[model samples]
Target: MRDAQITDLPDIREIYNYYVANSTVTFDVDAMTLAAWRSKFYYLGKLGMPFIVAVSPAGQILGYALVSPWKEKRAYRFTVENSIYLGAASTGKGLGRVLLGELITRSKAAGLKEIIAVIADQGADASIKLHRDFGFEEIGRMGKVGYKFDRWLGTVLMQKSLK
Candidate 1:
């Protein structure tokens, strides 16, 4: 695993967009374009956030993890929200644990105090378990907060503190 280069955006988008189109793991109704991903890439760069990707032995990107600003307000600068996506072939092999652990280490090194996880409650049991294993406590849940795949979905809000 290593810091994400700009060239990794397309693969990252592909991984994320797969979930966007085929699963409720993400609430996005439309696929995100490369341009939008570039914008987000730059935004996280400017914030000094950690955006890292896991690569296979053949140099293919297998998964990615990152943290974005939890809120725009200045007082919330020390906190960030986490996002992790793995290619379909990469799941269940402990890649998520490696990616998330590295992300937490980098976030702490970047002086971040908190990491928040906004996870889809449906079809994301593994994610919830992963976060809990990392000491992220479930703070709350929002029911029927999203409509996707022709059904109502909710979100589980989990948080971990670096301090």
Candidate 2:
């Protein structure tokens, strides 16, 4: 994995939009346009967060991982949340774990003290397992906090310390 470029936005957006529309992996109901996607990445860059992607030998983007502010408050500066998305056909591969592990390394290098993964719903077992395998512990769970696809969904928070 490597730093994401502006040109990689299209593939990233596509991978994310797929998860948005097809699953509770993300609570966002609307798929964002390329411009909106670019704006999000710009914000991450402005925050000095790492946004990395894994690519195929032919240069196709297989997956991406990023770090974002866990909260906007000053007290939360040392804590950052993470996001990872893969192409629909790419699930079940070990790529997500590798991508997230790289993000953790970057987070530590950035002097971030805590990393969190908020898995959207129980259906996202793979994500939960990924974070757990990396030594994250389940910190909390919110039930029916999100309404998507005509049903209530929950979120599980997993945390790991960079220090």
Candidate 3:
């Protein structure tokens, strides 16, 4: 695992777009463009947020974990939302835990105070448990807020304090 370089953006985009096209892991119904990912990479770099990726011994990106500003307002500067996505081949290999652990450590080192996870309620038990194991607590749930895969989907909100 390491800090993501500009070259990693394509792999990151592929990893995330897999979920976008195949699952409700993300609400994005369309694949994100490389330019969009580049903009996000630059934005996080400017904020000094954690955006790290796990790679195979062959140097292929396996997964990634990052924290982005939770809100645009100045008062929300200390809080951020966390995102983790692994290539389909990388799941069930404990990479999520390692990436999330590293993400938390890096985020705290970057002086962020909190991390929030907004997870899809459908088919995401492992994710909920992963966050729980890391000391994130379920704070709330919003039901029927997202329509995807021909159904109404909800979100499970979890939060952890770095302090």
Candidate 4:
């Protein structure tokens, strides 16, 4: 994994849109435009946060992982939330594990205290397992807190202490 560049936005958006359209992994209902994605990249860069991507040998972007502040409150400054996405073809190849491992390392280097993953309760076993492998433990569960795909969705809050 390495720092993502502006040129990688298209592939990133494509992969993300796929998830948006078909999965509960992200609650966003609409596929984001290139302009919006550019703004997201710029904001993360300005925040000095890491936005890293995994690429295939042929240079295709296979997946990405990023961390952002968990909340806007001053007291929550030390906590960050993480998200990860892998191309359908890239799943089960250990790419998510690799990306998450690097994310944890970057979070530690940034002096963050915690990495929280808000996982959709549906079809998130792999994600929960991945976080557990990195030492994250379930903190809470908000039942039926989200509605998506014509159904109610639950969320599981998992966190790992980085300090």
lDDT of 3: 0.96
Give per-residue lDDT, candidate 3, residue 107.
93
Summarize candidate 2's per-residue lDDT along 1-163 as a digit string, tens digits. 7899999999999999998899889999999899998898899898899899998989999999999999999999989999999998888888988998899999999889999899986588888989999999999999999999899999999999998
Model 1 sits at a Cα RMSD from the real structure of 0.6
TM-scores, all models, native as reference:
0.99, 0.97, 0.99, 0.97
What are the per-residue Cα lDDT tens digits for candidate 4 across 1-163? Answer: 7999999999999999999999998989999999999998998888788899998889999999999889989999889899999999999999999999998898788788988999999899999999999999999999998888899999999999987
Each candidate: RMSD? 0.6, 0.9, 0.5, 0.9
Q: Which residue pairs in candidate 1 have backbone atoms (N, alpha carbon, C) closer than 3 angstroms, thus clashing? A: none
Q: lDDT of all the models against the reference? A: 0.97, 0.91, 0.96, 0.93
How many collisions per candidate? 0, 0, 0, 0
- TM-score-wise, the better of 1 and 2 is 1
lDDT of 1: 0.97
Local accuracy of candidate 1 as per-residue lDDT tens digits, 26-63: 89999999999999999999999999999999999999
Q: Against the correct fold, how does model 3 do in TM-score?
A: 0.99
